[model samples]
Target: MDKEFKLASQLLTLLDTEQRWFTLAEIEKNLGLSDKTIRKMVEEINKQLPSTMTIEVSRGKGIFLQRDGRSRTVSEVISSMFRETIFYRLMNLLFTNVGRFSVEELAGAMFMSTSSLKKLIVQLNNNDLKPYKLRITYSTPMVKGDELNIRYFYWKLYGDAYEFTGWPFTKINFDFINQLITNIENEKKIVYFINSKRRLSFLVAIVLERVTKGKSVKITEGGYPWEKGAFHLPVKALAKVLEESFSIELLKSEIYFMQSLFSLSQYHYYEGSEMTPMKEVELHKDKEEYQMGNRLLTLLAKVYPNIDVKERFTLEIYEFFDKLLIDNAIPEWMTISKSNLTTYVQKECQQIYQEVQTCMQKWHTAYPSVLYNDFHLTKLTLLVRSSLRYKSKKAFLVIGEEFSIRHYIANLIKKEIGDQLIINTSIMKGLTDEMVQQHHIDFVISNFPVALKTVPVVIISTIPSKRDLDNIRKELLL
Candidate 1:
């Protein structure tokens, strides 16, 4: 990330946390910047943001983020800033460039001084590109690295940064790519998830852009199993379409690489009307992802036995593991910013978060190559919590009104918390400890204050209001 992008992201993030206006002094204090710099950053960010969203300034009241249409997230705002950075523009240029270029030519294309462009390349080489062993050689200004690593680096960079919001490849037609993906789906008898289809389009566009520029992947090993499977047919068909569309032939290695990308977990599945790729997962039990899923489930059982690892949950875990493996293999450099999710999980359910962290640590110990981070922990914790089938809480409704009113109150409570609570109605006159004990009531909901010593009592209006439901939720921990 660029320094300006980081500063702009910080400003947007601070504003996103609250809806109220912040005085200039408050903004300066929070961002640790001078008032002048803060104003400049805000102005630049506003220029990048769409018409629907903007940071509005007031004469005396400071600044506020205004949203007249669909709200944009802080990350989205940051990505918009990211696209304008010299670093992003340079990388995007390199990914689509056909051959090596003179330093002057490249700098002129970015409208930057040659010396400044060289310094930027040095910064990228020392920081972002260091991990992937990719570096832009100053002599010719071309990215040099392992072919697969190069492709993975750009795919992750563009995917994380753009994310269907904009088309980075101006030369490639988006509609043509979508049509090609639709053709693949129709021929392969599979349906790509909507988001997955977009991601696939991005990957295909990257591959086409790179390969057409004479940058083709080199297959080191004998090729993946999917190359000879049913999936290869669509890849071959896709290759033919590309050859005809671009007037270029794809190398065999390029075709194999495309096939591997398409076969990645959760991209598409057999069109059996099933939502997940459970059938595909079962067919590859011997795969590392499958074994990792089983290991994770066992670890979850030992750590958090209360969670039910049912079939649906099991498939979800498998899919998650598969994605983890792919991420590990590629070693993406771009940050998939989900800090909001991490914070939410840590605050909402610390116990489950810690449990997931423990399981992830154990799994990492078993397979050191598969590293886990806060992002992975947050995702897995959410999955486990979502799959949990909570035991119902028993509640007794005590109404002192007429029978019809009592039933009406009961129905209202039911409508509010029927999914989590089993409500039993009783008249306040006859409600006693014996009845409460017989029903095993976990809590009591009454129209008036009740003196129940065994169970907690929640007082509500004749017709339960939002506050009443909130009180019930607090008492029952719903």
Candidate 2:
């Protein structure tokens, strides 16, 4: 056997007898090996060890062997190692599933020497993925060009946490597949994006068709598990998949945040869990005050250089911003004004005014524009008619500014509950107070003070804070 394997076996025997944690120095001295050898041995052993058996290194302490209680017997340990290796390998393969890699990186990741790993890689190319056996095309005379691109593609398509439980061994034909992906990019046939779920779903279906060949396909890491052959896998895998698929090109769109949030939410839902408060908070925090809004304002400034500063401007600009998020238009809006209201409409609007006008044309074709000169001056109570349009007896109305975070949260809740949700501006009307007292509203949410005593009220804003709510709650009780 190899000398390294022999030394590893001897070390394992000693550790079995010790039955306790051993310091690095102690292991080094016992084996009569240098620190480098010991470290290398540790890494090698980790790969060979069973999943049930973990080699842990404490912060100040040394290394110790702990039983996962699941790993027993040499075969079982070996199987676990292979499983983990397969998991990581599959993840890497999926990363390059988009296409681009060299045999060298694939060999290194599989922990096999170039020659041995190549054989295993041949199996990947020859052996079908079963139900869906994918045939990959490699560029001619592959030496080394941009295999990293393939790795990046897989990462974008899947995530780092992806696994190929369906396949054994980490060995994958990354070089050949990377070449295929590069071709796909050059062809510009594959439309990789987040918002156009319909288009993206179609593209994914096409990819699956080419690879799976009507075979049983499993997409682990956040996809619809019941999606016939596809499976909703994990979060980490999804993140990586998105990174590989979209690359830096996706950064140019305005709906980047929404697309990112959708991906992030999908990953969290699968890998983490639904209703994870911390994750939800983190998602919102990341989207807080994106520079896009300010950028829009800058563009607005250039187009309507001397537009009136009426609240009408704010409402008009807000409508334009709404379309930007909805349509996912990414232009040079980021470099425009990004400060506040003035910056958003006067500056950003000017830059993207043409794009906005173009989008408005399409929207107007589908639905007639609400003829209103002054959106702010319009009574909030009058908008209640729009809320009542939803086919629900009870409704939760959240009233706030367009930029208010509460508005987004309320929209989410409304979508989930399918309630007749009303979103009103900050201004109040005569009937607004009466509507509150009547409790006609299931929930009245306001970021500002209101005399309305209608159904229970919720004030959602950062300024007042929850502490302030306590006082308001008491006042309502009185």
Off by over 4 Å in 2: 1-47, 50-119, 126-133, 138-247, 251-478
lDDT of 1 by residue, 1-478 (tens): 4888778878888888789899999988887899788878878888888778889888889999887535666677677677778778889888777455788999899998999999999899999888778899887788898877787778778866787488788988999998988888877667888767878888888887777777777663342344544467888888899899899888877776776667662445565646445665575577667788898899888755557776678877876776565445444422332346898788776766886888888887778866667877888999986765555788888777888988887777778665787888754456777778887998888888877788788888888877677567555443
Cα lDDT for residue 129, candidate 1: 89
Model 2 poorest 10 in a row by lDDT: 223-232
Question: Mind sharing the TM-score for model 1?
Answer: 0.70
Give each model's whole-structure lDDT. 0.76, 0.39
Clashes of each: 0, 61
The TM-score leader among the candidates is: 1
| Best by the lDDT measure | 1
Candidate 2, lDDT over the whole model: 0.39
